[model samples]
Target: MRHDASRRRFLTIALVTAATAPIALRAASAEAAAPAALPKLPATDAAAKALAYTENAAAVKHAAFKAGSSCTNCNFFKGAKGQAYGPCTLFPKNTVAAKGWCSAWAKKL
Candidate 1:
């Protein structure tokens, strides 16, 4: 009787844990499988040409960051360190820089 009781108790716990394990795995996988977002910049290579700059770095192919700036200090930027590109009221998509820049620019005070 004692052996049977122990076995039953262990089985109950195992079943419960097994059922919950999938839920936990799904949550973890959702986070792990998520792709890291790209950093946004003030302007793309083409967009930079429209801006007024005596030295449009992107225009001359001398841009400091054609596509590598972070979101901490971009014109359309709206975030802090480690955060993905925050939504830009200026642009259609949520984008910012991670060490990037262009001609069409403005420093958010």
Candidate 2:
């Protein structure tokens, strides 16, 4: 009886661990998959300068700049609607102002 009780306890522990292991791993992976916060891009940044980036689209001096073109409508923009700033594919690890404009801007489909 004693040996049977110990075996049952061990089997119970093993089953519980097996059942929960995947759940625990999934939780850990979800945390790891979370995106790190991106920093706002500065207008004076070298990349920004090369792209003629302006925080305000209306202030852009590039000849190709459209009157209504802005980061919020750009293909590269990854920010949520109404946000002040968000990530851009052109400037990894940095975010652009929603109202900003750059030479690399492509109309979002």
RMSD of each: 7.9, 3.3
Candidate 1: deviation at residue 79, Å? 8.5
The Cα error of candidate 1 at residue 32, in Å, is 1.3
Candidate with maximal TM-score = 2
Q: Can you write out model 2's per-residue Cα lDDT over 1-109, one digit (the tens) per residue?
A: 9999999999999999999999999999999999888888987799999999989998777888988999999999989999999989999979899999999999999
Q: Which candidate leads the pack in lDDT?
A: 2
Model 1: per-residue Cα lDDT over 1-109, one tens digit each: 9999999999999999999999999999999998576445344434434532222233344454444333345566555667544544444443543343445545566
Q: What is the number of residue pairs that collide in model 1?
A: 10
Candidate 2 to truth, TM = 0.75
Number of backbone-clashing residue pairs for each candidate, in the order shown: 10, 0
Clashes of 2: 0
